[model samples]
Target: MSAPQIVSGLAEIADRYDAVLCDIWGVIHNGRESFRDACVALARFQAERGPVILISNAPRPSPAVIEQLDGLGVQREAYARVVTSGDATRALLAERAPGPAFKLGPDRDDPLYEGTGVTFAPLEEARFIACTGPFDDETEEPNDYRERFEGAVARGLEMICANPDIVVQRGDKLIYCAGALAQLYEILGGKVEMAGKPFRAVYDICLEEAASRTKTPLDRSRVLCIGDGLPTDIRGANAQELDVLFVASGIHEAETLDAGGAIRAEAVESLLRQEGLKANWAMPDLVW
Candidate 1:
C-alpha cells in the first residue's frame, strides 16, 4: 500500500489522533525559545478533547522541563503532562549502588542527579561518567573535553547518556548533544548507556504517565508521535507501531523545502521513503 498522505496542517492531523507524543527540542521549540503558535496549537487540541503529552529527551525531569519551558514562555496548560529522559536516568541512578559520578555535560544537566543521592566526583576519582552535553555551550565541537574523555576511557569509567540526540538546532546553529559524546566514548571502547527515545526506557515512562491522565487507555494505533528527528523520534514511533507526524521544519529544515520554508508534502513523502519509514502525516512545523 502507498504511504499515508502528508497532512498540511497540525490541526488536521490533531483531530484524527486521540493523543500526541511530541518531541520538545525540535518541534515545540528550539533550545532558546518556545514556538508561540505551536503552544497555542497544542492548547487548542487539548481543549478539543485531544490529550497532548510533551515527551522529550531533555536531561532533566518534568519539573525542570516545566521551569525551562516557563523560561521559554510555554504555559503549563499547553501540555497535559511532561515526560523526559532525565527522569528515567534519575530512576536508573537511584536503583544502582551509590558511586562517585563524573558529569561530562553542561551545568543545566546537573538537575538529573538531584535527589538521586549520587555523589559527584572529579574526573580523576570518578567511578562512572554521566554525559549530558558539552561543558561549554559556546564551543562548536567537543574538542575542549577531548583530554577529559580520553582520560575517563583510559581509567575504564563507564558513561551514561542523558540525551540520545547527536545534534540539535539551537536557533540557527547546530550544536552537539550528549549522544555525540557517548558515541565517541563507545568508539574508544568505553562502555556507555543511553536513556531516551528508541531506547525503550524513556518511552515506557512517557506511556505510563500518559496512561495515568488519559481517560481512555492509549492505543498504539490511535496515537501519533510527532517530531523532527528521523533516527530518534520517527524511528522510535515506527518501532512502537504508532503513526507519526514528521515535522520537517526543525532539524531537517534544509532538506525539506528550503531553510525556514514550509515543508512541501511531496518532499516529506520522498524523505520518509528514503528512510524506509512513513509518517502518517506531515506538517511544515507545529504552526497552526
Candidate 2:
C-alpha cells in the first residue's frame, strides 16, 4: 500500500534486478514503430543485468515477434530473448485434444494455428475458437464480432484467447484486442481459455525463458516487469509477485499525469488502489 516512487529513468532500479521482463508493443514500440530510448534502455539493462527478456502478449510465437521487431527497426541487442503469448498459446493448443477450430484473427495471426494439428473449420463446423483479435483492429470493434461469437456459443465452441490484452496503444489510437472479444464471449456464457499476461501460464513461460537465457534461477523478487498496460502487464506482474516499473506516458498518461505532464502521484496511487494493483516505480517513459 505504499505510493509508487516516481523516477526519471531506469537507472534508479536497474541494478536491483537480475532480469528485466519488458513488454514489447507499448514499451519498446508503438505498434507502428520502435521507441529509440526504450530500446536503448533495454540494451543497457542487458549489459548491466543478467538478461532482459522481451515479454509480450502478441498472439504469435517469439520468431514472429522478432520479425515484427526487425520490421520496426528495434535493434538486435535490445534484449537477450523474446517470449510471447503466442508461444504459450501454441503449447496450450498442442496439449489440448485435437479438434476443428475457427481462427478469429487476421492472416498475420495464422502462425498460431500452424503445425498445431488443429485443423481450421468454419464457424458451424468448428469445435473451438482461437481468437487472436479483430481481423482489422483499426476499423473494427469488439461488438463487430458479436454475431460470430454468438455462433460459436451456439455451437458450443470454447475460445482460446491468445493475447489477453484488452486494448493497446497504436500510435495515437487505442485498438481493441482479442481479450476484449474474449471477455464479451464470456459475458454471453461462453468458456474462455486465456494464454497471456495476467494469466499464470504465460508468466510461467516468460520466467522459464528468463532463467534459461540467463543460466540462473531468476529470483522473482529481483525480477522487474516493465510495461505500460495496467490490466495486462501490471496485473500479470503483480500476480507473479514481482516489482513493476509502470510507464506513465503510455496508455494511462491521461489518468496519472496533470495538464503540464507532471506526475500526479496521488492520482496514480488512487488508480492503482482502485485496480488493486501496485508498482514499485513510475517513470514518464523508459530511458537509460
Candidate 3:
C-alpha cells in the first residue's frame, strides 16, 4: 500500500489534534524574531479550546525563553507553557557544579549557567567545556572551533552541549549552533554530552511541565508535535509515540519539496517506515 499523503495546511489538521507540541526556533520564530503568523495561529488554537505546549531545544528555562520571545515580539499568551533544553541543562549543572568549565559560546548564551555555581575557566584551565556556540557568530563556522576543541581535549576538558541543533533558521539565514560545535568536538575525540531532545531528560521535563498545568494528563495519542527540524523534533516525537506535523518552511525550504509535493512527504514517510513510527500530518509551515 502507498504511504499516507502529507497535508500542507495546518488548519485542516488542527481540529483533529487536541494539543500542540511546537518547536520555538524555527516554526514560531527565527533566532532573531518570532514569526507573526505562526504566533497568531497558536493564539487561535488556544482560543479554540486546544492547548499549546511549546517545546524547544533552547538552552534556557521557560522564563528565559519568555524573555527572548518577548524581545522578538512574541506574546506570552500564544501558548499555554514552554519547555526548553536550557532548563534541563541548568538543573543538571546545579546538581553537578563547582566543576571548572570552559564556555564555548557567546555571553548571551551563558544565561544557562546563571546561578549554577559552575566555575568558568579558560580552555587551558577548565575541567569541562559548556559549548553553546561559536564565540563570534559573525565570523566563526563549526570547523573554526576545531583548534579550540583540540586545546580543550589537550587539557582533559569534557564538553557539554547546551543546544543540540546543528543549524537553525535565523531570519532567512542558517547559522551554526552549539550542537555543531559539539559534533565537531566529538569527531575530534573530545568527550561531549548533550542535554536536549532526542535525549530523554529534556522531553521528560517538557512532559512534566505540561502535566502541571492541566488536570487532565497529556495523552500521547492526542498530542501533535509540530516542528521544522527532522532529526530533533520529528524523531523526538516519534520516540514518545506522539503524532508529528513536519514544517518544511522552517528548516527545509519550499523548493526542497518536489513535484506533487511528494518528495518531502515521502522523505518523512520513509523515515517513519524505517523507524516504525508515523506522523499524523505535515504542513508547509504555520501561517495565520
Candidate 4:
C-alpha cells in the first residue's frame, strides 16, 4: 500500500465512506474531557452521511460507558451506537459463570460483571482471573503485580482481559490498562485471553450492530475505522480489511508530530511500517 495522505479535516474524505467506526478515548475524548471539534465532526457526519458507530476498548459495558461519556461532554447524537470490549467480554465471562474468579480492576469496572453469573472470590479460592485493569491505574504499574501473578501462574489460571489497550491518555498523562497486565502475565508463563480491538470479537459485535442500524448489508470498502491506537485500532482495522484514519495528535503524538506541531508524514509512515501496519489517511486531529 502507499503512504497515507495527511488530511486537514474529515470533510476531505467524508463522502468516500458510508460509515465510520471510531474510537472513543483519545479520538473523541482524552478520558478527562471531550474533543469538541471531533465530537462535532462526528455529529455532522451522522446528520449528513451514514451511521457513526463508536468502537471503544473501555472495560465498562456500553450503557455504563454512556454515563462516563456524558460526564466527559460527549453528545448522545454523536454516533448511532457504541460497542466496547467489555460488551464482547460478557459472553466469555458468562460461559465460565459460577467460576468464582478473582475479579481485578477498579470499582468503576464492576458494571462489566453484572448478570454475567460469574461470582468473585479471593485469589486463594478463585478458579480464574478477570482483569479490567489495575485496581488503581493512577498509582499502579504492571510490575506491581509480578508477585501475585507468579502464584496465579503456578495454578495455571487463565486471565480474561476486558480491555486490550496497554495504555491510554488520561488528560495529559498516560496510564496503564488491562493489556499491560496481560502482557506481563504472558511473559511470566501465564495464559491471557482478550476480546477487544485487534481481536475479531469486538469488531464482529461493532460490525453486526452497524449493519443492523443501516438496514443494509455492510460493505467493507465503504467503511472507515478511525483511532489513535496503533496495536488496537490500526491493527484491528487492517485485520478486517478496512481503511484507517490515523489520529496523529493522540497518544502517539510525541513521536508522530514534529517541532512545529505539524504531522510528519514520513514519521507516521515509519512508525506504522515499523509495526508492519498502514493507515490510508493521517490527520493532526479529527476535525470537520
Candidate 5:
C-alpha cells in the first residue's frame, strides 16, 4: 500500500534481518563474473547476521553450482551455503523413484541426476520430463522445443521445471530458461511441476540451511530476500511473506529505467502494481 523505500546499499536495512536469502544470477553475478560489491555485501551480512545462503534457480546441484561459482570468481566467504532448484527437484524425483525420465537440458547439467535414482530414457520411453533449459541457451528458444513438447504432451508426460526463471541475463545477453519452456508446454495443455523461486521448495531449503548453520530457529520475519527478478525471486519472497530488497539493474532495468538510464521511480511503482509485486526497498545495484 506504500511506495517502496529506495536505498543505496544493503546497510540501509541490514539490521532488520538475521539471515539473507540471496539470488545468484543477476544479483550477485551476471553469469560471466561475480559482482565484487555484491559478494562483499553477502560476506558482510554473514559476518554480522546469522547466515547468508546463495539461493539460485540453477538446475544443477549445489556442489556443481559451487564449482561453477568458484570458476566465475565467487569467493567462498561470500555465503555460508548454496541452495539450488536442482536440489529441490532431486528431492521431488526421490519421491517418484524408479522411473525413467527424459532430461531436457545440456550434458553439463547431468549432476542433477547423480543420485536421484532416476534412469535416463528417450522421450518415447520416459515417464516424465525433467526440464532444466535448452542444450544451448545462446542459440535456442522455447519454440525450438515445440515439437518435443507436443510429442510429450500427446503421451501425457508431466514436466518437472527445475528452474522457475523464464529468462536470465548472461553478461549482456538475455537467454531463455526452463520456465519459458515449461510455460510454453503448459500453454499447449501440458502439466508442469515447478521447483524453484516463486515456488516454496527452494526457499524451504534455504531457510533450513540458514537455521542449521546458525544453530537457532530462524524467524521468517527476520530474513531478507535479495534479488533482481520480479517473477521468480521477488514474487516468491512476497508469497512467503518475507521482506525483500530488489535490485532494479538486472533483467528489468531497461523497462524500469528512463531513456537516459536513470531509474524511473514512478515507472517502477507502476510496473510493480501491474505485476502485483511488493518489495520493501529497491536499489539500482547491490552495495555495502
Candidate 6:
C-alpha cells in the first residue's frame, strides 16, 4: 500500500477523476448540521466532474432521508443521485417478505419496510430479524440485545443488517449502528447478511446509477470516493479498486487530529497502519 497524499482540498486533485462517490453522515453532515464547505465542494465537483453520487450507509432509502437532509440544511443541488444501504437492502427484505420478521432498530427507520410487503411480529413469533440499528440508540448498546439475539440465533433466524457500519458520528459523539448488533450476533453463532458499504450490493447500485447519469463510458478507475469511516467507506472503495480520500475530521478525529482540530499527518498514517489500510489521499475535512 502507498502512503496517502495529504492534500488541502478536493480541487488539488479534482481533475484526475471523472466522477465522485461521496459518503453522507460524516463527510457532508454530522446528523446535527450540514458542513457548508463540504457541501459546496461536492456541488462544485458535480458541476465540473461527470457525476456526484451520494452513496451512504443510511438505513433508509435515499428519498426517505431527503427531508432530513433538507432539515439539516444539506442542499438538494449538491449531488445528482443518492443511493443508500436501505435502498439496496429493501430487495433483500422483499425477497423474504411476510416472513414475520422481528424488525429491530428505531421507529424512525420504519420507512425501510414500507411497500415491501414485509410483516413484523414480536421476537417470539418472528421468523427472522431485520436490524437497522439500536431501538434507542442514544441509550442502548449491543449488549442490551444479547439475551434477545441468543434466542433468535438458536432458532436459526438470520439477521439482515441494513447499515453495515458499527458506529457513526452523530454530532460530536459516536453512536452504535446496525453493524454493531450484527457483529455481536455473529459472535454468538448467528448468520448476518449485509448490503451496505464494504459489501457489493450498495456499490453495484452506485456504479449503475453513476453510469446512467454519465454521457460516456463509465471509467471505474477515474472515480474518486470521499468518506470518513475506515471500514465502510475506505475499505469499500479499496475492495472496488477505487481511489479513496479519507476525511480525518469525522469519527477518527481523536486519532487523526490534534487538540486544535488540525490534521496530524503522522497520526493519520499511524492509524491507517494499525488498521492495515491505505488511502490514495486524505484531508482533515472536505473543502474546495
Q: Residue-wise lDDT of candidate 2 within 1-288, one digit each (tens)?
A: 998999999987788899998988888888898999999999888887778888899999889899989999999898888888998899778766477778889999888878888877788887888889998998999888888888778777899999998888999889999999999999988999987898888788778878887766778889999998889999999988999999887888889878888888898899899999999999877898
Question: Which residue pairs clash within candidate 5?
Answer: none
lDDT per residue (tens digit) for residues 21-78 in model 5 = 9999998899998899998888888887769899999998899999989999989988
Error of 1 at 149 (Å): 2.7
TM-score of each: 0.91, 0.96, 0.88, 0.98, 0.96, 0.98
Per residue, candidate 3 scores C-alpha lDDT tens digits across 1-288 of: 245457755677777766777899888888877788899888887777477889888776678888888899988788988888887788667665887787777877777887999988777777788877778766779877777778777776778888888888878788888888888888888888776876778778767666666558767676778887776887788788777777767776644466554447666567557756556666666764
Deviation from native of the Cα of residue 246 in model 5, angstroms: 0.6
Model 5, total clashes? 0
State how far residue 192 of model 4 sits from its true place (Å): 0.8
Across 128-151, the per-residue lDDT of candidate 4 in tens digits comes to 999999999999999999999999
Q: Put down candidate 1 lDDT per residue, 1-288, tens digits, no spaces.
A: 255566666777665677778889988889888888888888887777567888888888889888889999997778888988888788767765377888777787778888898887788988888788888756847666667778888988888888888889998889888888888888777888876876788778777766776788877677778899987898888888888888888888888865557667677777778988877777777865
- Model 6 regions more than 4 Å off: none
Q: What lDDT score belongs to each candidate, Candidate 1 first?
A: 0.80, 0.88, 0.76, 0.93, 0.89, 0.92
Against the hidden true structure, what lDDT does model 3 obtain?
0.76
- Candidate 2's TM-score: 0.96
lDDT of 2 at 31: 86
Weakest 10 consecutive residues, lDDT, candidate 4? 209-218
- Ranking of candidates on lDDT, top first: 4, 6, 5, 2, 1, 3
Q: Whose TM-score is higher: candidate 2's or candidate 6's?
A: 6
